[model samples]
Target chain A: METTETLNETQLITKDQLLNQWLGQRKVTRRVLDAFPEKELFEFTIGGMRTYAQLTKEMLAMDGATAKGVATGEWSTLDEEKSELTTKADLLASWDESTEKIQKYWKQISIKNFQEKVVAFGQYEGTGYSILFYVMDNEIHHRGQGYVYLRALGITPPNFWEQY
Target chain B: METTETLNETQLITKDQLLNQWLGQRKVTRRVLDAFPEKELFEFTIGGMRTYAQLTKEMLAMDGATAKGVATGEWSTLDEEKSELTTKADLLASWDESTEKIQKYWKQISIKNFQEKVVAFGQYEGTGYSILFYVMDNEIHHRGQGYVYLRALGITPPNFWEQY
Candidate 1:
């Protein structure tokens, strides 16, 4: 609501700072994925939650495509189904690819574009930054589940605040 | 990592912009909680997820306390267990109170303080912004599940993009 008003000279965060934060959390999440047993990664569910592997696929499908969509204003990206990669290795490979895609596409998004609203996948709509925040938030959401799943299975998640 | 280097001459997002973005998301999350059926708000669970009311309590307990914790280097604040709010109306009231607390405590935190490293609740540690980001991420994670629970319960969630 207040975003429409004239901005002050000082900024809350820089583009690089934001990206670094995202990437750092991503690293922690990757470790969370790795901490899981191979079978549990694909088969385990806690309290009606999806398996970690399926959650990873969901993140993979949306993030890279979502980044591309934001940079280009294309909505069809959401139509792409979640990655079908089954094995842990394959899933990690796909995850790494999406991470790269996010970085590459992120560079294409202008600072001014962050405030422009776009309809993502033709349903949920928000500004470029909000959508990006949603993607990051979505990843953290699933990752948090992974943390719980790990602890339930007697494994500890990676340090969440180790990103420096 | 890049924070150690010389600072940039211009900022990417102002302090107001960041706060506005956070408040906007909080508004969306509140709407999500409000959308739940009164009975389900406390008793409902989808696939092992906490009830919306419980999840709201977790958020309420952490956020305002976290803001206060950041403003002052206080670790004991984390010991304040989540509110035992049983009813939906009570939970919403607690939620409203925390929102106000966040606004009040947030102002006490200096911009420079955001970059300082401190241990929270005698466990997690990170720069001020990273810790704050974790709190926000934690909220969205639970809120996202609440959204799913709503869909499972045959209710429509508030538009996420409406935060603009």
Candidate 2:
């Protein structure tokens, strides 16, 4: 493939591996969301933390926008305002939607794109690869909060390592 | 470089890049640790989450052990029981110590070891590469909890993207 043919000597992980990593993290995060009881997800906050519901919205918005931004090199911020999660169903639906959207646009990205620099949301600057990792990394961070929240609420989060 | 000459066609990121990424993340996480107030570091909990101090200890334990395990392939489980952090000074001191240990041992890991499968702590099965990523990824997750905690405490977190 042209992508492989053009691989930089410095690169050590394949694009496929990175994509799978991204998707797998999302799967585990979705389980954590599913584990939440409807009331506590939005209401539970320790030390003035945002509710898991609120944090999940931030993840969804970033995922959807970053998917587009990485594909098109145009970051959109205005439309990604705080979304309401009236129920666990709403949250899960949004999560699945973003995942599908990510897969869809991920096809448009070429190996060249991964190395091209782009300013995400017209603010944070990174290569296509770093930005993608940033989106995935941010999700993990928020998911950790869910873990803490779950434990505090006396529920066990999905094993973070169970990602496949 | 024997390591580079032996690279699998599937690898896309170099070992140096991964190590730098790992270290850069720790740099940012340390900043997060420093930002916490002495009292809040241990005293704060949201919805029953572990305090930042407790969370940091977990990161320190995992980092120190994983460094050794990756270098020696002898995972040590008995020695990493959380040490007392009577103050923030003690915590930062330990964090610095773990960082040194990771650097010293990272030299022992080669491209071959990364692909070699080993069960971490006699339970989690993954390649050296995957296990290394897990340690870095876990820090980000917990560092995020610190972000929420800081925000809840009404302080802004260090810009996460600032990693060099």
Best by DockQ: 2
Candidate 2 local lDDT, A1-164, one digit each (tens): 56633443334455755777788889999999999999998798866767888888888888977878878987887344455658899889989998998888887876667656899898888777677777788788889878877887789788977887
Best by TM-score: 2
Q: Which pairs of residues collide in candidate 1?
A: A12-B13, A12-B14, A47-B47, A47-B48, A48-B47
B24, model 1: CA deviation in Å? 4.1
What's the true lDDT of residue B14 in model 1?
42
Residue A152 of model 2, lDDT score: 71
- Candidate 2, after superposition: displacement of residue B16 in Å? 2.9
**Model 2 interface RMSD, one decimal:** 4.9
* Candidate 1, position A141, lDDT: 67
lDDT of 2 at A100: 91
Residue-level lDDT tens digits of model 1 in A11-49: 445566678888887888788888888999979875455
DockQ of each: 0.22, 0.38
List residue ranges in candidate 2 displaced over 4 A: A1-11, A43-49, A72-74, A82-86, B1-12, B46-49, B151-156
Q: Model 1 misses residue A111 by how many Å?
A: 2.1
